[model samples]
Target: MARSQAQDVIRCQYCEDEPAVFHCVPCGDELCPRCKVFHLKSKVPSGHNIVRLSEKLHPTNQVKMCVVHSYKAYEACCEDCQVPVCIACIQEVHGKHTIGKLKDLYERQKAESEHELTKMKGQYKSEIIQRIKYFKNGEREIKTSHKNIREKMKKQAQDFIDHISAILTEALDESTRDEREKLMEISQYRAEAEIFEQNLEQLIEKFETLTESSHPADLILYRKQNPDTFKRFKFPFKINLTLPSYTIGHINKTQNEHQFGKFIRGHISHLTLWDDSLQAKYLTGFERVKPSTKKVSGRSLKISETKTQKGELYHVSCRDDRSAFVSGQGPGIQLIDRSGTELDKISTDWEPAGLAVMKDGSLIYSDYDNKIIYKVSLKKQKKIFINTDYGPTGLCCTKSGDILVCMHEILFSVVKYNSSGRKIQEFETDQNGRRLFHGPWSVCENINDDICLSDFSIFNRVVVLTKSGNFRFTYDGNVLKQKLKDRFNPRSLATDSLGHILIADNVNNAIHLISQDGDFLSYILTEDDGISLPHGISVDTNDNLWMVEENACVKVYQYLS
Candidate 1:
C-alpha cells in the first residue's frame, strides 16, 4: 500500500486519528508512530519492507521463486502437474506435461473471471427473480382458495364441523410433503448460487492483484484449476409453483361470526425445479449427436383403405419409392400407388403367393402352387426367374439388387439369389448346425442387410440372421407378458425406416416392433390401430406402413409421425 504525495494528509488504518507515517504493502495498511512501533515489535517479520509515505517508493510483499532451483523465477505452468515450473523443471519433471506461457495463462484467467462475474451478476440474478415471482404467485393463489373455502364453510357451518378433523389431517400431510420438497429445492439453489458468487469474487480479486503486479506464476497455477469450473454452468434450474384448493375444515358454529370455522390451509400442488438447457438444445436444431434415450412411444399409426380390388392380397412389397406391388391368393399381381390408387394388374395362372419389387419398378413374385418364381415388368410381360425344388412362400429384394426367398418342404430354410436369378447361397441352419427355422412364412431384409423371417411353426418366433447368414437372435414374443397371452404366431415381416422390425402377430391381431438387434421396441400397429388378423406388412419409401387383413381388406397407415 502506497499513498500519493498529492494527498497531504493520510490517516492511520488502525487508529484512523493520526496521519500515516509508513506503508506496509504486505499487510496492505498505513500506520502511525505508535502503531508502526507495535507492528514492528510484535508479529511483523524483521525483513518485511516498510516504506515511508513521503519517500514515493513501492513496498515489497512476497517474492516467489522456484524452490528446486533457487532464485530462478517460474516461467511456465505444468497443467498436468498442477504446479508452477521454471525452465529446468520443464525439461525434467514436467517434460511430457502440457506447458502454458505465464502471460497467456494470466490473460485467459482474467477473461474467464470477468465472464463468471458477469453471469452471476446478470443471468443468475434474473433467474432468482423469476423464482421469487413464481413463489409470490403461489402465495396469492393460496389466499384466493382460502377465501373461497371460508365462504363455503360459512354456509354449512354446523354440518362441516362434524368430520372436519380427518379431512384437515390428510390435507396437512399432503401439503407438508409438497411444500417441503419445494423449499428444499429453493434452499439448494440458493446455496449453490452463493457458492458460485463467492468463488467468482475470489477469482476476480486474484486477477485484480495480478493485473497490478507481476505474479504470472501464481495465475498460471490457478488457471489450471478453473477451465472446467463452468462447464456445467450453462443453465439454472427453473422453479414452477402452484397452490392446491382447500376444502372447509372444522367450524366453531357456537362461537362468534369472526370464529365461524377453523381455516383449512392450501399447499403447493405443483412445484418443480428443472433445467431448461435440453429445450434450448432442441431450439438450436441439434442434428449431430444422437439422443441419449431413443423416442419409441407416444405415436399413433393411422389406417386408411386403399382402392378396392377383386382378389385377396397375400404378400406385399414396396419398391425403392412409394409404389407397392401385392400378390394375391388368386392368379394375379396388382401394382398400387402410394395414395391407394390401383395402377396396373397382371393376370397369371401361377397363383402368386409371395411378392417383391425392385428399384426399377420390376415385380418379382413366387407361385408356390406351380413351384415357379416370376419377374414381371410394368408392361405385363413376365419371365421365369427361378424354379425351386422347395416351394417359395416369402420373397424380399435386397439393397444389392439380390433376392432372398423363404422356402419350406419338410424342413425350413432360406435361399439367396443374385440379379440373374442364380442361386448364390443357401442358409438352412445356424452357424452351430442347429435347425434355424421350423416353418418360415415371410422374410424381410433390414437396412443393415440383415435377414428377418416370420416363422409360423409351433414356436411362432421371428428368426434373425446377419448378412453373411450368421445367427443373430430370435424374437419369440415371450418378453411381452401383457400383450401375448397365446402362442406367438407370426405371419408377415417388414422393416421400417428406423431400422425396427415389424412382425404381424397373427394371434394377437397386432404388429410387434423390435430393434434391429432383435430387442422388442414397441408395437407400432395394434388392434387399436384397426388391425385385424394382420397377415401382410410392408413399408414404402415414405416410411408409410401397408398391411393386409385376412378378409381381403388392405389398409395403409401414416406411421412415422
Candidate 2:
C-alpha cells in the first residue's frame, strides 16, 4: 500500500497516512485496517500478535516476568527441574536440560496443579474434616459419660453415709437403754436398804418393849412371819451394764476393689479409622490385582502336621514358637514346641477341651467333664478360673487378657471373664434379641477385638460380636459356595494380625477366610490341601494358622505370606 508519512499525526507505520487501528506486537508497528490485514498475512512476521489500539494500553495476554531474571520473560521450561526459565537461566542454571515451549509447559503444569488441588480438597481435606467432626462428637460423649459416672458415684457415697448413720443411731439407742436399766437397779437396791434398816429398828423397839413387858407376843409373831424371808436375802445381781462397741465406719480404698466415694480415671482410645494403603489405592485409580489363586491352588501355605498320643485333638492355642498348647481326651494339657515335641504336660482334673494362652505365658484350659476352666501359671501353680453350668467347649485369651469362653450344651453362649475369673459380659442373643449361635464350638477375638464364634449346629455359621458384646454380623458359608451335601459346620475359629477370621469348616474340610467386618475373602485351604475335617484353629503372633484335624493330627499353615 502506498501512503504519505506524517510524524505528528501518529499514522499507521505500513500506510504512513491513516491513523493506527491496531498494534502489531512482533513488528512493533501501528497499522490502519488495511495495513493490519497486510501485517497479519505477511510471511516475515507471521507469528506476531495483533492487539486493537484501544486495548494496547491494557494487554490481558501479557507474559509473566522471570522471577530469577526480573528483566527477562520466561521463554522455555526445563523438563528435568519442572520450572520455567528465562534466556539467561537457560544457559546458566538449566543448561543441558530438556526444554519445552513456555506456553505449552504452562498449560500442562496448570492442568496437573489443578488436578492435585481438586483431589486434596475433595478427598484428603474432606476426610480430615469428617474425622475432626467425629473427634469433636467423641469428645462431647466422653465428657457426658464422665459426668454421669460422677453423679452415680456421688449418689452411692450418700447412700453409704446414710446406712452408717442408721447403724450408729440404732447402736446408740441400745446403749442408752442399758445405762437407764443400771440406774433403775441401783435405785431399787437403795430403797430395799432403807426398808431393811426400818425393819431392824422395829425389831429392836419390840425387843425393848418385851424387856418392859409391852409386846412379847407381837415380837414373837413378827419373828414367825419373817421366817420365810430370813431363808434367803433376795438381792438384784450387780447390774453388768456393758454395751456393744460402736465405731464410725469409712469406705476403705482397697487395691483392685470397687472403690466408693472416689473418681475412677476415664480415658479415650486412639482412633485409626481408615487405612492409608487403601486410601492410596483408591486415589491412584490403577489397581494392581494379584494373580488369582482361589480354585485348585497349590502350596500357598507351608504346612506341617503332628499327631499326639492323646488320639483326639479338640483344641489348640499357640502363644509363640516355643509354647503351643494342645488339648483333647488327654490326661493333661500338653505344651508342645513348634516341632511337635511335648515340652510339658499340665495335669487336669477332667478331660481338657478348650485351651488358650495368656499374655503372661500362663495357660487357660477348659475341662468339659467338670465344666471348669483352669488357669495354670508357668510356675506350675493352677487355679480354677471359671465354672460354667454348661460344658465349656472353646476359649480364647483376648488382647486385653480377658477370657472369652464358648458354652456348648444347653446354654450355647459366649461368656467373657477377666483374668481374675470375674465375668465381665455374656453374649447369648443377637442384636434383635435372637439367639446368636447354635452350639458354639469355638470362639476367637479378631484384630479389632470383635468376638467370633464357630457354631456346629444345624445353622452352621460363624457369629460375630463386637467388643462390647453387641452382635455385628453372622457368616453362614453362603459367601463360600460349596456343595449342598457338605454342610457349613464351623468347628473352630481363629483370627490373624490382619483381622482376617480363619474358620475350620468341618464338613467341607477347608479353612474359610473372612474379612474383619464379616465380608468373605476366600478359602485358605480346601479338601485338595489335605485338610480333612479340621477342628480347632489358632493363629500365632507370626500369623501362622494352627489347626487340629479330626484325623488326630495338628497342622500348621503359614498364612501371612
Candidate 3:
C-alpha cells in the first residue's frame, strides 16, 4: 500500500512562521506565510527599479538631501502618474491624477481570492450524499430482481418433478424415482448457483463503495474536531469481475444437457419414508391422574364468564407477566394483565386485531379495521409500520427478531418485517411449492425458523412451512384427530423454550402443547375457573401463559409439574 501524503501548509509572505500572507514590507511583493508587511516596487524614470520594503526605504525618505533643494522632506503628487514627489520637484511636477490607499486595495483583493476555496467544500459535501444514496438503492433493486427470478426457477423445477411423478406406475416406479432424483440434483445444483449469485451481488455492492471518486483537501482539516461536518464517506466500489459473470446462470444452459440433468439424484437415497414410529416419545415419566389432587385446574374444561365486556376483545397480547395488550371492541388497543386490569390505552380510530412484542422491547400490532400495522416503542411512542392490502390477523416476532404477520381471509401469507419496522420479504404463494395454508389465523416461528400457521379453512390444523414458505407437511385429519382428545381448532400459536408448540385450540377450549416434531405432548390449559372460548393466548417472556377468555375477562396460569 502507498503511504498517504499530508496536507500542504499555507503561510503569509512577511512572516515566515506566522502565516505571513499579503505583500512583503512596503514593496508590494507577494509576502511569505504570515507577516503583515508590504514590499512596493516601482520603475524609476532612470530605468532603474526602486523597491521599498517599508516606509524607511522610500526614495522621498532617504537620508541624503536633494542636490538642488535642501531642507525638510518634500511631498507632491506627480502630474503624470501621481507618484510621490519632493517639495523641490512638486512645483516642477505641478498637478496629479487619482489618489488611493495602496495597502487597503491590496488587502481587499487577497480576501476575495481566499474565499474561493471555501465555496468549493460546501458544494462537494451535498453532492456526495446524493451519489451515495443512488448507489445503495441501485444495489437493492438488483438484489430483489435477482431473488424473484430465482424463485421462479425453483417453481419451474418443482413443476417438472411433479409432472414426472404423475405418470408413476409399478413398472415405471424405478424410472420415476430416477427421474425425480435427476430433477432434485438439478435443483440442488441450481440452488447452489443461486447462492453464488447472491454472494456475487453482495461483493459487487461492496466493490462499488470502495472505488468511488477521490477527494483531496487543501488544508489538513482538524477533521477529528469537526467529526459531524467532515464525516467519512464510503469510497466508490470496484469489482474485478469478468463480464460473463454478470450475464450469469442456467438460463443459458443447453436443452439436451438440461434433459439429461433430470435423472436419479443422490440426495433422495439419504431420505427414507418416515412413519409415526419415527417419532420419539417425550419422557415426562410421571403417571397421569385425574382431578381432585390435580396440580393444575381440575375443572371439567368448562367455559364461564368471569367478566362480561360491553364489547368483545379483538386482540389480546402478553406485554409481560403482569400485563398484556388487547385490541378490538374499542377505538384503540388496551394493555391489561392476566387479571383483566386495564393499565394503559393506545388510542386509535380503527379496531386493533393482533399484537406481538418485538426483540427490542417494542409492541407491534395490526389495526385490522384500519388495514394498517402499528408499532409502539417501549417508551410508548406509536407509529404506523405498514398499510397492508388486507386485514392482518396474526403478528409475531421470531427469535431472530423479524416480524411475521398473517393477514386474514387471504391465502396464508407471512410477511417479514425488520426491527425498524420495514417490510423485508413476504411468503404469500406456492410458486415455490404447495399453496399457502388458506385462512391462516395465526403464525409462529418454531425454534428452527420453520414457520407454523394455524389454518381453519376446511381443514382445522396447523401447517408447518419451511423458512422459504414451502409446505413442509400438514398436521391434521384422521391421524391428528385420533391422537388428540379434543378438537384442534388452533387460533393462536406460541413456542416454549423447550421447542414445544403451544397452540390455543379455541373450539375445543384447551391449550395443546405438542412436541417440537409435532407429536402430541399434553394439554397445557383447559377449563380452569370456568374458562372457555379462548380468543387470544400468549406466553410472556417468562413463559407464563396469559389467556383471554371470550366468555370471561382474562386469566394467567403457570404450567408446573
Candidate 4:
C-alpha cells in the first residue's frame, strides 16, 4: 500500500523525474527539492515564492517572497526602501530603517489601486461620456446654423433679383411711353402733310383745266376768287427724336463679397483637464499666477504742428503713414506730411463738406452742393459713392470700413453705409420719438462702437448713442460751464483708444474731453494750449490727437502714452 501511494504522487513539472515537493506561486511550477534549488539559481527575478506542495495557499493569499532572499518569505517591509524584506534581510540590511508588516503594506497598496480604478469608472468615464454628448450637440447646432445661413443667403439673392427685375420693368415702361408719345406727334404731322399735298394737287389740276379750257374768262374768275391762295404754302417744321440710352454699372467683386457676407472659422484645440487643487501638490516648481495691468498716460503734450495753405481747414483725417488729409474752404483736399509738405491733392468743383480717409488709403468726401458722396481711390480714380436727398456735412469711417454720414436739410439725421455703399441704418430719432439732433455736424465712432456726434444746433451738445442707435447720454457742456464761461459750440468730434470723447468747442476755443458715458473729463486742448477755432479733430492709431483749426493749421498732440 505504501508503494502504491508513492507512485500516485505528482511528479515535478521542471525535471519530470521526481515527485513534486515545492510549488512556485508566481511561476505556477511544481518542482522536486533538487529542481527547486536549480530554479532559485536560474537567471529570473528573485521574488519567486516557493512553498511545500502540501502547505501551498490559494493564489490570493500567497505569501510575498523577498527579492534578495529567494528561499525565505517576506516577514516585513522596509518603509524607507519601499521594498518587502524577510526577517534575515531586515536584520542584515534594513535594520535601521522604518519597517511595516508585509501583509499591511500589501493590503494598503491593493486597496489604493482598487479605489483609483473605481473613481476612474465613476467620475472620469462619466465625464468623458458627457464630453462626447456635448460634441454631438455642437455638431447638430452647427448644421442647423449652416442651414439657416444658407436660407438667408438664398432669400437675399432672390430679393436682389426681384429688385433688378423691377428696375428693368420700369425702364421698359418709360421707353415705351416715350416712343408712343413721339410716334403720335409724328403721325399727326404726317396727316397734315398729306392734307397739304392733296390741296396742292387740286390747285394744280384746277390751273391745268383752266389752261386747257382756252377760256380767259374762267381763268380770271378763278384767279380773282383765290388771289391770296396762289402765293405760297409753308411746310410743317421737322420733328427730331432722341432715343433713350442705358449705361451698365460696373460690378466690384470685393464690394459684392462684403455685401454677401462670409463664414468665420473658429480654431479647435486638444482637450485637457487641470485640477486646480492638485496643481500646488504636483506643480510646486512652476511659476505662480500674476495680475495683469495696463499702461496709462500721465499728461497731454503738444507734439507738432503742420501749416497748410488750404485756407480755413474744416476737416482733418490722420493716415497710418503719419501724414494727414486736410480739407478746407478751398477747391481741393490736400494730403500733407508731418513736416507740412504737400504730398497730394484731389481737386473738386466745390469744397468738400465732409472728409474721411479709408483704411485702404483711399479718400471719401461729401459734396454739399451736389448732394453726393465721392470716393477717390489710391490710383486717383474718382467716383460717386452715394447720392443723398439731403446734403451730407460731416462724415467718418468706422473701424469696419463703414461710412457714418451726417445730413441736414428738412430733417437732421446720421446715415450709415457699408463698404459697398449700401445704406444699412439711419439714426434720426430716439426711442421716445424725439429728434436726436437738430443739426448733426460731425460724426465719429468710439472704440466701444458707440456713435458720437457734435450737434451744431440750438442745444450745442455732443450726442452719444449705442451702436444700435439707442440713446446713451448727451453732453451739453453744462458741467464745464464754470470753467469755460461760454456757450458750448461743438463743431467736430473724435474718440481716442481709451474711449474718451474729444469735442472741438468752437465758442470756448478749446477741445473738451469727456468719458464715453458723457461725463466731463477735462479740456485737453484750449486757448492756453494754442488751440484756436478748432474745427475738426481725429485720433490716430498711436493715440495722437490731430486737430484742424480754422486758419488751415493742423496740430498734433500726444494725450496717451
Give me the candidate number with maximum lDDT. 4
Q: Please list the Cα RMSD from the true structure of every candidate, rounded to 1 decimal place.
A: 45.9, 9.0, 40.7, 16.6
Model 1 poorest 10 in a row by lDDT? 279-288
**Top candidate, metric TM-score:** 2
lDDT of 1 by residue, 267-385 (tens): 34333343543221110011222323334556755656764455666677876455667766677777776566777778888777788887567888888877789988767678888
**What's the distance in Å from true for residue 528, model 2?**
1.3
Which segments of model 1 are wrong by more than 4 Å? 1-297
Per-model TM-score versus the true fold: 0.50, 0.69, 0.45, 0.52
Cα displacement (Å) at residue 557, model 2: 1.9
Clash counts for the predictions, in order: 1, 0, 49, 0
C-alpha lDDT values of all predictions: 0.73, 0.73, 0.60, 0.80
lDDT of 2: 0.73
Q: Which order, best to worst by lDDT?
A: 4, 2, 1, 3
Better of 1 and 2 by lDDT: 2
Q: Estimate candidate 4's RMSD in Å.
A: 16.6
Better candidate number, 1 or 3, judged by lDDT: 1
Clashing pairs in 1: 1-25
